[model samples]
Target: MSRLTDLIARTKGNDPQLGADLEREFKALSSRLPYGLNFERHSPEAVELPLRPVRKGDKVRVLPERGSTKKGDQRLWQVKAIQKAKKLADLELLGPAKTETQSVALDDLVVVAEFRDTIYPGLVSTGKVERGGDKPFHTVINGENYHALKALTYAYRGKVDAIYIDPPYNSGAKDWKYNNDYVESDDLYRHSKWLAMMERRLLLAKDLLNPAESVLIVTIDEKEYLRLGLLLEQLFSYATIQMVSSQINPKGVSRGGSFRRSDEYLYFVMFGTARPCRMPLSSEWSTSTQSDLENSSEDGSPVTPDWTSMMRRGSEAYRNDRPSMFYPIYADPITRKISAVGAALPNGEHAAPPKKGLVAILPIRKDGSEGRWQIGASELESRIKQGRVRLGRSTSYGFVVNYLPDGAYADVISEKFLIQGYADDGSVIAFSEAGDLSRVASTQWKIASHNASENGSSLLATLLPKRKFPFPKSLYAVEDALRFFVLEKKDAVVLDFFSGSGTTAHAVMRLNRQDQGKRRCISITNNEVAADEQKALREQFLRPGDADWEKYGICDFITKPRVKAAITGKTPEGGSIKGDYKFTDEFPIADGFEENAEFFTLTYEAKSAVNHNLAYARIAPLLWLRAGAQGLRIDKLPPEGWALVNTYGLLTEVDAAAPFINAVRQAKALRVAYIVTDDDRRFQAIAQQLPRAVEPVRLYESYLTNFSFSNGE
Candidate 1:
């Protein structure tokens, strides 16, 4: 037992909750080692939330009721006294004139919190930027993500479609509080803190995800990939786990005598019904003429232009096999032009003969048994309009019809084809232009084998030319990872707690632009400066919360601005960025996304006030996220005691239930409604009257219910 540990240990015994990693650090730091400038955030700058109640001498800052403050209420003040009855606190200025005092609502004040303290989280809108249109607002929250995740559980529990996190690799690099060089060992002392941190956040993250169908993507380097896998297994025991070794760092880092570390691990914890979607690979041999997979006829005959028999060949060719597909194709024998198609008959029933003037073409086999067409009646009609289905040759009854097999028939049924336009016959001319359908993503993703070896630094420089990070993920790499999951989920709710530099958000925007999807990304990061920078700031007598100090924090300095530049298509100086995105989809950088975004700072609120509806303003954004981050939000209490929007509604007063119910009936696309009341009977009565589609959530009770649970995290 080191003397340093003994000194910090509780009077009777050591604090059981205190991490053993901290104990090791206490010993080493006290052993007198030389400190380095390689540092990280000034934690105090992001938050000075000492987990204690406000007292007469505690220095604090006042808060704005609406929107985020630019310079924040930086003037220092002391908690003069508490008026419990009025629910107000008096704050005295901490300057030379100590007598000046003012009273403010206790709810507006944030006193910070500890584990024991139940925090009612609040959102302060910093600002917003829009590229236009009615896109759901992608959010970037600047706060300690641990508390922020807890807050999100109330809004997004059981609703998130995917969560992709690039957590700290826990390489034990020298930082603000460090006194040594980067340590590569994965010993208990180094790994314990990171594992514990991830365990806590992942557990909370579980509540946010849709257990029925969601994916948890975590990227880690060799430093903690093994530990992360074990921890993920421990936490998500029921999930289908798989690790993808992506060669993100193709040019491996030569760390002393060991092999150069290049590849990193991506662990995908897939929940129920969640699976990787197959992607298309542009065929090397495929030309515009060979877009169709086949070239010759089954009878060893030469090709006839771009047409193939409508009769399904090979296996499953019998009418009984696909009874509904054995329908008739109506064609004009004289003109050899298809007029219309007949409907599919029930099993054991025959298709009704075509009208008198039209000749019916049946899938009759040479062996004299009935066969089925390649597609159904409706599919044939659609293909006929595309000019894909046309007359092939004269048959006994009419001109035998054929359809253009431009691509794999199976792919046409299961994949999203890129439609070029309609042909003269109203046919949907399309192409399968990307990944090869038959190619599967291999477990060992070597850099030499894949095109995803994008330099993280070089890629970030394209979006943010002036800023940099210790490890910024390649934008294209994130976009590729997201495409596998969100490609099919147009409205997926993707979350990234460790959203350093807001790379995930930028990636989502690019994904949405490619497919025109509604996937909303929620990014959370702290506004903390680098350790060496913090040291420099302190030397100038600048402290946390100071404008200059806060400016360099990650959220203010990088994440928010990066996302803004992506959305507005301009640099901080309001000039077009000098480049185009050619990595995946080639587009000019100045051509910003047609998306909307809002910035927020997750702040502490009084739990009591939340239960009594006194903190509704602060909690509105949380509810908006829960209802799906689309359309307008219920950011303020409605004057009519209730509010209705495209996605959600709120009923503040049950007396106004009639109006609220009428509004609910009128809303064409309301998914969730919140009732602000204390009485369980009142809540149920109101809930029963609401439409079946509207999920009636008890606003105040919902807040407390989310807080009611506890776990070791």
Candidate 2:
């Protein structure tokens, strides 16, 4: 007997109650560690598990290789009894035919269970578009995003500058799927499933981000924002995290008996010194009027238009609230200018009058309530000496007090008062005591331009014509979010995994067009069919696995077409519907877009091929992508007799080694060369002959290790 069985038997004989309690505890713990017995699935060891004896009551399935099998033969079975000595078991057919039993060898049975990862890493190039130029080409990858991310890790690990993803919100209207089936609201572990899906992909994505200067932006609604926030915090503990509430829908969506939902959230996870740039305010808030004074010194000037309020208001504006700011100001009765200031006393009273000849001014509201001044007694004294404080018109009590103009005191006063005076041109004149004018960004964001369901749909419809995808993100919204980081780093690399309808890529293109920069984007998405399309396909007997199903799916039908139209300035029908951009004032809106991009699909290579005999063609595009997709093909040497890939080249033929070395020495741009040869002596010979600037690497020897993976079972 096994150790557990023997222990149970001993416990039962000693004390029946103890044995029952121990057995119950063991059963509960066993359920928690269900995958422990299948250690081979989780182990990192290179070897496979050896054959082992089947346990009684263990679930199994018959091998599909067995000939002449009945319809029910493929179903799961239970091991009723196992003869340890013979290595055979009495299997009772499960499900409909539970009464029947058959004696089968243990080798013919396999465990029926779930494992963490099912797909292997491999990439198959479906097609390519060669719009040759100095412009960087963007890539749209079609596959399961997880596997695509894994494949990309071999090439782009620690190199991406930014990643913006809009994952499924898990609203439970048959929107997202797990194991090829929609995860309905009634599912007991729906939330767990959503987390599991996001966790796996996010972990892979973490590997691709540049450790020192990268940012990850994730957008989510109320359904899973809390859980996702905690998850991001857990995974990225070393990074600085900030959450912003974005109003994507100002009108708001009505929920049952609850407040209308008008906002979603953005989690900006910054690594190292990555930060958002101070962008120019929106058009409505951009206009500003400069002061007329020129050549003013840093110190306060006599003719400076800058001024500030003398009285304080709001919550902490009372004398009892901040007694230090409630002192009295002495003004010259003849000049109507502040002459002296009194300090605050220990008993919450003002100090003795500065001079008996000057008039004392106290802060009092129109309702006869005591109030505080904007500055403390010491600051008031300094301003009085500089002639910054002056008396104004008399109140109903026939008393003159200090006052500042609406334009000059706007920054110190309430924003409501500033808006009242500057509402004509949306322009405000903010002056400093040093006589300088500066622009400040407003905290309040306008929500009209960020309507996702409406603006996003209209943007995609302009390119796609059919509205193929559901509820995409607003083009300007994503552009605005990325603009914070990409504004200065125009050549930065951006990635999007949940690239529904490819709005993120479209935004990147628009931003580059506006700035005349060479930014590159990489978008990954799965070809999952939409809910309505899936229902229609099922009605037509064309399920998910059917040969023609993928042709009608989102990645191919929606994402690829949208990206193509946006790049080439023409619709899929070969007609031009392109117009000028509207968002920028620097460029004409009617100039149209002139950009380039390529499309690719992910596929897997056999484990044997990747390990023993990997070919250059299988991994060339990956190299090209890593090189910023500068050129389309790596098949032939350039006209200069050497192929150039971002200052790197691979010399395939031994006969071309001399020419490659000569090219390396002649071309000032070349920095690295990969010599492809099986003979180590020949590789070293070429490596030694290369210039000091050019570093030679042996193909399939130096780089293949990065692409290796576990057995693709």
Candidate 3:
């Protein structure tokens, strides 16, 4: 045997417990299967490609090599076969020369797929709501969330305080799509494809979260919760993970035989010391408290008294079930004060009898049935020592046991004490000496206000009379979930990549309006039409490439309109639907959320040889958006293509470097300057002239490189 193995064997002989553990571990390792999570008939070599090479029947173009072809020599070719052994691909030439076949090196070809706005990763402002002041403006991006997330990494990487996403739950009702097709329930690899999509986006999202002070909240249903939990655990191993069951649908959806589904879950993966804020309990809970506890003391201090029934009422209340909890409590009969707690013996006998004039308090129900105490003998003794346990008059029956409210003397209650059956209203319940009841929010969130789907649809229907979107989350739910984390962080930046129906942005606006705080939201979603809608559009001779087709998709039709109506209190046709608030009694609906939001669509620059050859027109708007869209004027271009926006000077050409620096010197308070140039020497020379407060950033070299992707022509 090897030395290490021999030593372990010897150690096992000497220490059997440790040895057994090692033996079991070794057996577990030996018994493990070679592969895990096998998908039937799926082969990595046959199906999966990391870089996604052009396959048979794919349209492609020959990329011109240096000094090899004329400027317009490239032509579209249809791929026939990729011969891996020979590193060559068979291609058939298109357009008039239909029968021409040729073999070319793999490196000489590029896929000819149309470029998605997200794939290009540049922002083009479509419209804006001018607040006409220094108010924070929210952003809504109309593009694929994946590309939008990638673009955001350039500007908001490690800067966002929180990310809340309600991704498609992959329920089999054509709720979501993959590769432009709805993944049905029968699709064997549906789970795998969902995981693959989520993994890519989540990795990018992890970079955007501030590791020291952020939390990532993802909502999911029963279909993929187990797989998603494992994925979250794998990716965020360092975070403090918690899974909360949120009641979004009180009226359960019936599925015969199986349990009716009523609740979805929120996976809160918190990094560092991030925690939820405390919230006040509903007035119903406060009114239910005993009236005597609300009375003041002789010195005018609020008199706080804790109370609990002497008898245990649940399944484990029998003396035989928990003999340790069937202990005796000795109290002075006249004073009605607990003097000592007596332990129960192994034979279910009392350790000692009560002294003269002292009566033993046995746990007895109203029907005189034998029962056990709420706490064990050790805990009873601890409470007695702290002068918390007392014999008091019962409102329902005879003399009963009472105790001080846990943490009654402290200014605020700890979360641990609240978890011990303190209140039935919610997870974390707290009671103050002034008879005030508050809820200390924790991982276990079971609030009735966070109903899953109906409220969301109702709110949307109120905003846009006849329009409908499937399975939207309640706005109050999102607002409450964020209120737990960002209540104190008024200026925090919140991002939601899967921004369906724009609920997260609406929640943020509501929060800001309620608290008069400035919190900005960035929402990104795709403009893809539903499967049935796409079919209908195609039947009407409308194609995906047509602008009219896109107007009917989720981003343009649902997300944008919902956000606009929410902020403006007017429908898409400019009709006011403002009246009483349907969900809450606190505010009128017509008060209208006073906020500003800018809408932008993702666009791409023309394909170029050098990575940094992107034009100034494309890079300028992105800079404006990243700087919070302050004073953005896309209609007018400055003389030298250099403009001062907010606190930054954006120079598109190095030739305008002298004028840009002169302008920066003129405005001595410039915080930073972004210079777009391909030449390194020019960037350095211009950067040297800027003041110390003005940090210089090379647009193409530094900023743009972060978002550069391999677009196959």
Candidate 4:
């Protein structure tokens, strides 16, 4: 038996209840631990209730006295009876072992569930914005993010490249919700509830990321940075994690007798081979330390160049080891250019007769010992023509020779070597750029565009007139953060669950416009009304499901409109936005984006209510996203047995495989083939018939199939 099983058997001798309890506790603890050790999870315990109206026989946990300092009951209770007139409910303790009762106000008890509920996830299209091209539309899903994440796992499991989120900071204001109720600073369990909410959502988000190479970027402020860091550390213990301090507020927000708040923290959680890609330094670094650099050790020594001495050093430098490597490099002492390369001399023979017009540089050690060149005469001749072989400083014998080997040459062209100014000799000068987190002395990101007031709020006002969405992220700040991960990844599928004003998508669109990348962004947010808006709506007897209330939601009013405006170059008022995005890349907002976007709202569909053909329309978006989310989407089910689009092909019926195969072979742009079937034999045979370049995805009767994304086209 396993260790846990053995322990349970030994403990169940006198009481089986104790053993059952031990088993349940062990599994929960093991989920959080590295090796399922006995260390109990370190957390503030609290019960998170579901969002539903109170009903008879519903399990619940009574809320702690609101605005009171005391903690509330953490145990589950079943509603025994409800008095509608009194707005009170009688509750009995859950579980057969405990018999307890209480009567609480209806507002205090929130209906909860002890068992996991089933949900038939579906997407309903709300709108679309197009630039009249074949670009795969970036998507914005308007719903509670948790459910949206759940639905994404089915379509994009292990396919996402990066996830960047700027969730609510949980800063004691009612900026966020827990089980449909706004969690305020005065609530004693606010931190625990926030943690619980984030924990659930992040766990789901984890499924969507490619475990082999993906990054998770989360932005937070001072209020919850410490707790958020600990939570991430606990979840991703095996991955590399880091934090960055970005200055969003230059002047800083002041509190009585406290230091001004100037910065927020960003946690970058990298899994597998994922890491931050370096870029040309512009303004991500602070200039305040300029004078300090002059006084520092960096000014004391000159950095070494990648090109090494042609004379072999350290390993096998002698002529006897390799006689062919002992050749002469012919270069002019005045012009410092290679004139010719001389053949190697016999093993122990003396120097060959001198050649006129150029100085012959022989390999000589610093201690005056005979050494060999790194390469032979034949290779040296080819390298000299390509500028890889060059002349170095004059030695006592002659001008020393240097050469860039194949590996160093590869690094230069691949941008590992940062090109500095060249020397007088015309040798390409380059320096090293850091690939470490500790390269900077301080953690502050004092970028000018990161200023929240100017770039975030004011810039947002240009596209959206009079819409009040608090604390939207700076466009360039999100762009800079995303650029490090996805700049090189042209088709990276990025996701943002807490998309407030759609800045994440806007950032991605800007990135695409600059480099013409095919990167797609998926953003999820709820259409929640602001606190003041809720009060106003309630006064007019308009609740949440009302059309008037829904129209003013954050998704409908702010996120969707902002995305459309940013992409179409027109504000909500149908006028061109009058400003240029300044930082990293500069372009007028009126230039717009050559991109496409679609909007969706999450809907829970009952399988009993819909047939297979009708359900296909709901999941068409998923199939489009799975097929690289590029080119024209096969947006509907194949009307005539097969659907052939730019990026992928789909076969709806088995009998049409021959024509489908012919079409797929002809379309050079098609990279994926979706074959719908129930039989394993049919799927295998159909997949084998496809061209070598096309990846086959099999979708079965229940929508469960091998969703394979062949890494790249």
Candidate 5:
């Protein structure tokens, strides 16, 4: 029988209850220890009968494996010693802290069970390869696509810097999908499902950011904007929120209802640091144009103006000088400050060329024939053909070109389109109809306004051509708002988890591409929705293929297969698309209290088995050994030529002159800690022999700090 079984049998004879209690304690203790030691029973009735035999050197698995350590903490223990009933068998486990051990009843303690041949199993070796160097440069890619967002989050946990997403307007359209299906009906669970989806990703996403960094920026309409805002508060407690307004279609009211509502609102949330220190607020605002850069005529001061003032005042001149640049802008029906657009102009749309105030008409041919110029036509044509055309200014004015021929440029550009308008009755009402050209447009956007840019429709068409993506945002409005936060040259990392059509990425790329900045971005997206319902009815269209579309759309590249095409920048099949940025997926093991722990063990010298009642008698042998080994100087000797350890576990000072101080007054013996309870004679004898010997301290002083000896000698 095992030692525990024998102990139990002995105890049961005297106190059956104590034996049962001891057995129960032992079982519970075993379960809590690490390793696979389970307790099985052939019969619950005869509990203490036959315990499978346990030999002295029987090998038994003990403790579980200790996983990786956290960033700054150290591993505490390699094995743990657990003591069960005082009489039962004791075991030492070599494994992780808080590991469990299963136990089988004596009757069923499978003697043939496998034993641990290896001391520590399942531990990760340090030789395992990592992704890159110990330190690596990280970057973030922003875009309004969801699948990409999910993929990135899954791939890189605890590595992202920012997360900015602006979802659909939720205008009763089939935009967002749930569970690989569309949210058709006003299903009460629809919103909840969306929240749950976000929750799943966010729970994982939260682990992705470093403790020092945070997430930022998620735009939404009022329909579900408030709900999203609250959700953000719950998810990211350290987030700071703000609403930015962007002019959609300057000429509001496209659906033709009452007053046109064009202004749109974007909800932005910044995470990590309390707030970005020294973030350029001007970048969030519209960038300055050429006209804005001109010096003030009054004092040669820079005549920089806000976007609205600049646009309104410069509208006339913008239209007259560059009629092709005119486009309508929209606003929100409720708040005039919020533009109908998602902010930022669409891709490939030409911005209004910086106004130079100088205007030059194509010189009419001398014969009144088109393209038949009089003097410098031949020279200009030759230059144009060679793509080096530079029309020379008049000899009177060096290289100066003028529209007003005044001092310096002012804030507003003259609006020729609106300046030369007439009513249907053939009556010119241009000046009268013209409102405050310098007044800032309403925060709420209008759909049916005349301040539309010439490329407005085309730009919108390029982004949301067939109105496939409901209430798609204008790139300009988003850019304008981003200007308030995103800087041009700084190493900013932008994130957008709720990417729609990859707009945020497009914007980030455009910003850097325009300025040649090295700003990086990260975008997360889940492919749960469809691009269109007609093709995949009730089916998920936002799948891996959709992500591929975006990736291929940008650079016509697929990172996975490009390794084979590295030399030629072509796939094995001779495909042209080749990805430059390496893409990878990762599953990182994170650190947490519940996930890992620190365990410990206690050790001391053991003496021959003897029922000794004296406190010092029970512990003196071990104390003496430690003192001799550690060379603790003291003047003491117990009755048996050893140091006495009192019941209190502390050493009694032999010298009355200095009770606390331990000094060597004897040549044969040394000072040591107190012993087990009850040996007074030994204490006195040691005191007589050695003058200043005191009880020794505990082994793990870092753990047991308050231990003391009670034999007050």
Candidate 6:
């Protein structure tokens, strides 16, 4: 053995695993050798020629050796005609090289084939699950970009149920990489890539949705909202579109020019739902609490407690178009009950008592106070019981109290009472206004009078932290959009390719926590700006200077920051963050290959020998299975009415009259043996003479390459 082989063998003898890897590399090198031309073997004495495969139709790239300076130059050849060796002189390109060339073997020429292109971007291949320590829940491959997204199209090919995309808006700040290129503001294809990228993802996304369930909602902004809409129309046959203006926050963007645009609009488009054009009631629901009301305490009133301001605001809102249910609320102090609840009538009209039982509160004494005011629940119950309440005469339900007012009137009067100033000690603020207490009536709230004190920011604050993550969407916003479709015990899969700071993930987490629903979110992000890296850096600051990064979040950082906040109750929105989150970083398998299976050796046998026959059985017939082919037809059968079969053809039977049949029928004589004959009746008749004899017959021809039967007679 060579010194190198000896050293490798010695090293492998010590480290078996490394030795196996080295051996694999060595074997791979042999299989990757360059292929070559074909040659005809007319005679063993004749020399071979270097020639290509003369197929009926073959298109190949040609490389010409034009530069003469090179000593060992090989000319580049392109596609030539399909001709025999004798007709080579007819081809123009073959004329120059024929004089100096000799016949060559067929294996000496490289063969080429036509190129095939695909729309898929990444490599998608099935692989076995590897179980060990520090592994993810499961390994899914070829999920990168177009490849991953397109793979989903196969299962949902040609149709889909719904398409929801939260792609990066290309704000010029966040990292949104497209095709190995960062989408910076300077690049012209920034919008094109964004569109194209979205276009491809959307095509696949669109196919996944069912025709009946074909509804797509894109949460995008001024950047590419119109473009996205156009793309949608082009991709989908039926497109009914609408844009909903959602007041996400009362605050506006400060451009230092004119005004800030605080609120954003969501483009809602539907293709095949029962209701299109009109915004359908979302399966998603929003949760409202005292936290949602601005400037008001948990008691639900304006901070300042100005009765006049409340009255003015109430009167204004009363005149404007508002939900009939939100009309004015008037109460009498005496019974401490609501007298009338509705919008004010026009032309200074006094609303008639629609119900006889309906009664407003009357001050017991001269002034309404803590002791003198109270409403009777039974009185209101009596009104309903007595049929005092009147239904609306027309479609518009005017102010009509069904029963006597039941609840106590709020302390502060007037709409302005919503505003409150700081006290000297900042302990208790005064409710300065007590405008009027004549009649409690239904009223509409005016848009202009809508103040901050009437708004709630708690729920909104939770999803959108204070600079925690920029442009973080409000959890309540997501809830409002998703609540309808969500249900208990239902497992839903939510995917967002444009996952930023994982708002969608957070929203899903919050939803699951509240409803105990089984919803999993598959968020895809390119980490363009290195969001994960930035998070790591921030985490480093939070840790001790000397803490090892690999081990830092191992236990402490087991959860993502968002997940940590979710579980630890450290959310921006006050309230408990719910449920435990398991974080797993998915990684691709290292680039290489591994052995799929191992083969074992077997001993030689008579049956093995028979299988190796060309006229009978082919040698190494077992190789046919490895060659990915199956089944064989045998034309002949064994003749043994009473015969002795050895191990090769075991003959273990004994019979006085029919020995061959007895031997053939012996169980000990045939482990890997069977029989056949051209004449069944003759074989059977002879077999009857033997105690335990059998017969064999022919089937078809052999297909095995190595099959042959050679015996010295």
Candidates' lDDT values, in order? 0.72, 0.66, 0.68, 0.75, 0.34, 0.35
Off by over 4 Å in 2: 1-120, 129-132, 283-444, 543-547, 578-580, 585-592, 635-647, 652-658, 675-704, 707-713
Show pairs that collide, candidate 4: 172-185
Q: For candidate 2, lDDT tens digit of each residue in 1-713?
A: 27997899799998776786577556645654332221111111111111222567666665433332222244557788888788888888765523878887777665432223333344456654444267777888887777678778766889899999999999888788765457898877778778777876888889899998999999999999988887788779899998887787888888777999988888999998887764334444322222222212344232323333477867798778887776767766665556567776455454345577777777777787777788778776664544445555655532444434444444435332222232121223233433333223333345566778766887677777765677899887888788888887888889999998999998998888777878888999877777776556655645343457777878778888888777766677877754444454233322335667878877544445544535455566776665556754574433453465555677777777777777677776555677767788999998998888776767655545554441122
Prediction-by-prediction clash tally: 18, 4, 2, 1, 142, 124
lDDT of 6: 0.35
> Which candidate ranks first by lDDT, i.e. highest?
4
lDDT of 5 by residue, 151-250 (tens): 2332244555555656544555576654324565476555555555554456545655554655455655446666666666666666666565555556
Tens digits of per-residue lDDT for model 1 on 418-467?
A: 55665444444554444123323456654332333344676566667778
In angstroms, the error of model 4 at 567 is 0.9
Error of 2 at 679 (Å): 8.4
Q: Candidate 3, which segments miss by more than 4 Å at Cα?
A: 1-120, 283-437, 441-454, 582-585, 606-613, 631-642, 652-672, 677-696, 708-713
| Model 4 agreement with the true structure over 1-713: per-residue lDDT tens digits | 28878979888885686786677667766665453222333232222432246878777888654444333576678889999999999999976665888899988875553213344456778888888387777999987677677678767889899999999988877788664467888988777777777877788778888999999999998888888888888778888999999899989999557999989999999999987764444424635342323212343322333456677878788888888887777777778787777788877765755878777777877786778888888887777666676675677878767777776666655646576655655556665555211122235688888888888999999988777789888898899888888978988899999998999999999889888887889999888888866766766756455578788889999999999999888988899989887876788888889888989987654444333456677766677766766667676777788989888888889889889988998999888888877676887898897889998887634343221111111
What ranges in model 1 sit over 4 Å off?
1-112, 175-188, 282-438, 447-455, 710-713
TM match of model 1 to true structure: 0.66
How much RMSD separates candidate 3 from the native structure?
A: 11.5
Better of 5 and 6 by TM-score: 6
Each model's TM-score?
0.66, 0.66, 0.70, 0.68, 0.33, 0.35
TM-score of 6: 0.35
User: Which stretch of 10 consecutive residues in model 5 shows the poorest summed lDDT?
Assistant: 591-600
Model 2, global lDDT: 0.66
Error of 5 at 433 (Å): 41
lDDT of 6 by residue, 1-713 (tens): 36656766887998765675565455545444253311121111110111223332222223112222221213323323433554331112222435433322222232332111122111212222121121111111212334344434432343433334566777664456553335687875567667656665676566555556445667776667777666666666476676655555456666558667555556655656422211112111112222223223455433332111111122323323322222233443334344554442333333423445543321112132111112233433344343222221111222222211222123322342332543331212334244211221111111211121222233223422442334555544554344333432234444555544444544555555455554444444322224344345444442112234322321122113343343334543444543222212111111111111111111122333333332232222222211111122122233332233232121222223344443444545332222233344544454454333222322111211112211101
Candidate 1 total steric clashes: 18
